[model samples]
Target chain A: MDLQKMMDLPGALAAFTYSDKGDLQSHVLREGTELTPQVLDLLAHSCVANQAIASMEARGWEALTGQSGFQPLKGFSMVGLEWSVVVDGNCGVVVKNRDADYEATFNALQAA
Target chain B: MHIVKQLMAIPGVVAAGEYAYRGDRFSYEGALTDEFARMASILCRANTLSVNMQSEIFDSFAENIGCRPVQGWIVRGSQITICAVGNYFAFIENRDELLNDVMTIMRAKVGDVQDDLLVNLYARLGGDTKEALY
Candidate 1:
């Protein structure tokens, strides 16, 4: 995923890619944002955990309910009090809550 | 109407429910069987715990960057999306504008999640909030 392009998203404070095990791989931070690499690393790890859990839930829910259209998970977002992180696969973008466009962010992640 | 009923009224909302903070009990309506709803309750519990911890960690790092008291979460699958706000969870189809619509109503209905996590949830579930000491 192109971290720079992810940065172009509205209200994006930082965009990052992480390893399958949740180590921060690469990132770009908008200058003057209060975020630090250390925090982003933690965020990356949390994103990974959230994704894995959500994917498992999707698979199990579909199978148990005999439902369709739930496999191939797309993305997950944590809606914080003032900001949020949207993550898909190994990449994620943190956006200011007031400016978050959930659909656009999910589409961007999917395209990447 | 109750919040769960309100959510179920939305066009693409297939299942809506109120789940326990620890995944022990739940009640749901619409397409899911009882066993499926129980699994959904467990899933919501896991996601809630994960996000609450992350919120606390973020708060510690930034000292009130407004990431505290997580409002909710959403997971979008290929054609189904699950959204949880407060103790309520909804599974909806991915038709155009459905996610946004369902999210808007859910957020408006549930309001903000309390910082007193366990206490707030227990109070809502009829437990003694003061004694919980959460």
Candidate 2:
């Protein structure tokens, strides 16, 4: 599915897709959103990196508890002063408002 | 340790800990076992790394336009919330919906101790420290 469809969600400022290797695959920013390409690239990479780290941490937890299998990390949401960024699988969406319902928006984006 | 205890006293905070930049748990309070504490530390450290990377990228881009880096960040999960405060990071595993309140209490208790924690972390790491803490 095209990640850009996330832009349809209210308050979504931008949507992006990236590989596990941090390579940007696609990106869409709302019109008049004054963000640079470098910033978008960085957000994408950070989202992917956050997922990688969370996965590692989850594995560590499973090892510590002797649980053979633990659910994989879905993504992470970082609440910044001005925006909230959420990443699921290989796709990320940035919402302009910090209080936006990122989890719901992310779910809708994935379900699209 | 005192700050950790205070954090644990907050409503909805199931576990609380103080961790170094490299995922070492210096002190913690709550129902977590030692192994779980270590895992929590690693998770919190990873959260901090993500925040730092994002800050760096935003700062670099902002610098070009006469702006500043982000001061801090909050990462919310299903049952956990991690907040980065300078060199040290603190997190609360909570089931209640008072994440902001928990973060506020954590920052109030541990915010000023960032330098002290960094020094202690440096001492524990045999003088090795991240340049950002300097």
Candidate 3:
């Protein structure tokens, strides 16, 4: 997803692209935002770990329950005290919790 | 009046329960079989740990950034979604406003989670964290 598009997301303070291993490749931060490159880098790395672990859970859940619809995982979101980060594949966007639309954020991540 | 029972009372809640830090002991109610419940327990533990680690890492980068002391997390799938607050986990079928309702209720019940993931979870289970290895 284009960094601009990600930035356009409601409450979005930043958008970034990360490596499969969670290294932050590039990022765009909104003006006057407290988020720094260092913070975004750490956030990217965490996103990778969390997403991978979530995928594993999804697979195990399907196998154990004999259920479908959870596989091919769309995305993952970590709800923080004041904000949330939504990510899919290698793209992620961080939005303020007050303005976050989790459903929309997930949809955007998948759409990207 | 159990949290699991409260969650199970929701219309679209398929399963709700509490899992131990090790993911070995769990108690739940809903449509899942014994094996499925076990898997869910492990799933919740894994996710909880993952998010907790992430939150701690974020705090290390910058303190009081509002990402620390992680509250919880959600995995939104195509039709099924799993929401976790503290040691409690809920599996719900996606529907109109159901996710928000369940989340609100769970947050209200579980309240805000502490920063120490191991201590936070172990305290709820009445276990000693000092001797336990992460």
Q: Estimate each model's TM-score.
A: 0.90, 0.64, 0.86
Candidate number achieving the greatest TM-score relative to the actual structure: 1
The per-residue C-alpha lDDT of model 3 at residue A68 equals 91
Docking class of 1: medium
What candidate 2 gets wrong by more than 4 Å, as runs, is A2-5, A8-10, A67-70, A109-112, B1-13, B20-25, B61-134
Output the lDDT of residue B24, model 2.
66
Give the candidate number with the greatest lDDT. Answer: 1
Q: Write the per-residue lDDT of candidate 1 for residues A1-112, one digit (tens) a residue.
A: 7899998887898899999999999999989887788888999999898888877877877777778887899999998877788999999999987777777788899999
Worst 10 residues of 2 chain B by lDDT: B64-73
The CAPRI-style docking tier of model 2 reads incorrect
Indicate the worst ten consecutive residues by lDDT in candidate 2 chain A: A66-75
The digit string of per-residue lDDT tens for model 3 on A47-93 reads 88877777877787787667998877878888888788888999999
TM-score of chain B of each: 0.92, 0.66, 0.91
Residue A61 displacement in candidate 1 (angstroms):
2.4
Model 3 lDDT tens row, B1-134 = 78889999989999898887677778889988877888788778877787877777778778888887777888888889888888898989878778768877887898788767777777656756767645
TM-score winner, 1 or 3: 1
lDDT by residue (B14-132, candidate 2, tens digit) is 66666665676456777677877777676666565557556656776764321122324455444555555443344555344455465455445544333243354455455445564
Residue pairs that clash (backbone atoms under 3 angstroms), model 3 = none
Clashing residue pair totals per candidate (backbone < 3 A): 0, 0, 0
Reference-based lDDT, each prediction:
0.84, 0.60, 0.82
lDDT of 3 at B28: 88
